[model samples]
Target: MVTKTEETQLNRLENQVDNGGGGAWEYLCMVRKLKVRRSVKVLKHGLLILNDSKKRSSLGPEEWTLYEQVAVAAMDCQSLEVAKLGGMRFFVLKLMQYVICNLLQDCANALQKKFPESKRVGRLEAMLLEAKGSWGEAEKAYSSLLEDNPFDQVVHKRRVALAKAQGNLTGAIDLLNKYLETFMADHDAWRELAEIYISLQMYKQAAFCYEELILSQPTVPLYHLAYADVLYTLGGIENLLTAKKYYSSTIDLTGGKNTRALFGICLCTSAIAQLSKGRNKEDKDSPDLQSLATAALEKEYKQRASDKLSVFTSGFKSLKVSS
Candidate 1:
């Protein structure tokens, strides 16, 4: 985990790079180390270094990596260009302000020519096919890679992504299920699977995924909040109570800074309150919990979003929790 201090420092360096202050290399290194995405900066600065023969030559073997990095960043921005080598022109496509497809093809071709046996280069080709909307070619390329190395995690992920890009949610889920069977410890895949399940209204499966996530990283408030949401959607007396507990856990884990969890508390309590009415027995949950959550929500709004305070209060009033 990058410390808050380190993140602040990175933000400062990133701003410096944006303003042409010349710390692009250091900023890129830190961003990569932290696994953060700053593609705009990466493309702008990486191309500066890659396109310069003098600076590019100084890095030796690492220059290849910078080429790949810039290529990937350019793909993210979807910028296009044409690469001319030995009088042969290759059209490069880009998107959203970044030089993309053709530039990526240029980089991939260069890498493959230099290291013909490299699996990474092959994967890059597959990615290029995906970028160009050649779904069949991309699928075949990914399949071939997997045939060579059944354990190629990257290829497996790309295949799943390809399925998603093709609007095959069912296929994505199937692929993810199989992927998880082998890479059971991949939290990101699990989270992604959970999200897909949620999107499909497969709440039971989503709940299971969230449960696995919570077991893997119990301290992550996001898992708790997500699990609470799924349980709340499941909606029964038992599920509601369980959802309330998870929501409370999320609130505790976030130190009461999670407004969603607070609102969840209010909603769960209100629902439980309604369900318990006329049962001829007092509910065990404290009525004050809802009021406390409401108060905290109001305070949060007052401190940071006073302009929206009326809307917030009115929403609670609609939920009949204003009292």
Candidate 2:
């Protein structure tokens, strides 16, 4: 039998849903309201549905949001059972609600309680300690984990990331080199190691990394561009000429739409022109070098201008329609 109070609660829920504001938190608030009024049966019935395997498919992002909200609420209310179940669900969600959402401590504590002594939990605890700036503790935890599982990929990646976060570029480089020994096919790792080398003014190492990337995926323009840039940085007549070839390849791969390639071509051509200008003024290649650079600059400028004009025209049409 629906009583007056139940009718009022139903009306409130209907109103909230109709207004498009019935999110996870709002539903949980409604649950709390019912509980405060001693509506245990209704609360338990709703909990049963949320816990049901049969109803899992119907839940979307909002439902997961509710799970997190309820988990925190359970922790606050000292309800271990709810917190345990919520933590398990969150682990299945791959621990997203913890670190990425920025409530690291709460989720970490909840997960630890649910699965104390779990390897994944230990990893997360180490990360959480690192996040909290307890570097000593974090390092100890990472060291212990590594000692236990030397080749654990997840732990290895996290250790490298932790080294980077601690401003230890050399350490990070060493760790990545060790990692690549076992996982040589990780293209992104090679690229990242190259970036670190570039930042550290280690052009030779950066060039080697880009060379590895080129060998692994010869057709990619990005690797060509990077190799060109690094060679340009480590400038000499031979390096400049090699840089020019790579830049030309980059331009070909991208159909001349790449500004970096255009500028690189211009720079290499001018430098080569100067180098060969030491030859007799009548040299064909030296004179043609200037022409090549001029043509590249002019073409790049015109392409960029055309692109900007198209963007402006589209924006103006969009405003006209909206008005």
Candidate 3:
């Protein structure tokens, strides 16, 4: 005897097929058979079929309705394969519903544990491995996915990030450059490339990339800060002056309360002071250097006074000193 819920589910499934087409019923039967046989490969293929069917424009309202019903049935089957299939379908359909989508994430999570060594579960296993900090394994999973689908940008980005996390700057930059070739205007990619170049001590190229990012997004303070760092690495006094201008602009844009505001001010002051001292040592009779030194000293004094006042008035605490 069918329970009321089971009978209701079956009636709804039947009505869905009768109202429009029987394609949904056929797909559901296929899903049941795949589950009964415990065939992972066939189950994966069946999920893909259902995904395609749901995406088809030819699928009418009734078909879509039945597709959702079938997804529910697959989810309720309790097999890891079925759960994974249903979760993948749900993820594809309602990616924006993040809170509820956690259910799908849970399904993927469980399937990953059950099929720990399965390469076929690429994306799910990649995420699980990433969660476990198995960056090398995650990279392998993403690499395998890319082998099958080279144009997948998400996989490419994940692999690049994983490479960087694993201290593979060369690999990260290579992937980032490839990503840029495919997506030229990706400012984040350009910025990341600049950072990797800086890490590799390629200051000239880093400066160029940072300059490009600044051109695209002139208002972002971090871009200006990174650009300043690159310039300081390449040129001395002139670069310091340029860096000062950018730092000032960043502070102004951030309404003067950015966490790095004091740090930027300090660096600019120190660089200017160093440049002035260097010039004085080179030409003791140079009035220009003396004047520059005097001006830098006054600026540093004023900044220090302001910083002390800020600390007292706003209870502003500096971050812990790092060695």
Q: Which ten contiguous residues of candidate 3 have the minimum total lDDT?
A: 314-323
Worst 10 residues of 2 by lDDT: 73-82
Best by lDDT: 1
> What's the best-to-worst order under lDDT?
1, 2, 3
Question: In each prediction, how many residue pairs overlap at the backbone (N, C-alpha, C within less than 3 A)?
Answer: 14, 0, 0
Task: Give the top-scoring candidate (TM-score).
Answer: 1
Task: In model 1, state the lDDT of residue 289.
Answer: 78
Q: Is candidate 1 or candidate 2 better by TM-score?
A: 1
Name every residue pair that clashes in candidate 3. Answer: none
Question: In order, what lDDT does every prediction score?
Answer: 0.85, 0.67, 0.58
TM-score for predicted model 1 compared with the true structure: 0.89
TM-score of 2: 0.61
TM-score of each: 0.89, 0.61, 0.46
Ranking by TM-score: 1, 2, 3
Give the per-residue lDDT of model 3 (tens digit) for 1-323: 23456556655654665465444545455435333332332233334444574443354544433333333333333222223456667664444333223443554654446566644445654755664567778888887888888877767888887787678889998989888888877887887898788778999889888888888888888888777767766767677667666766666776654435445444555556556764534333233433343344345446777555444333312322111
Better of 2 and 3 by TM-score: 2
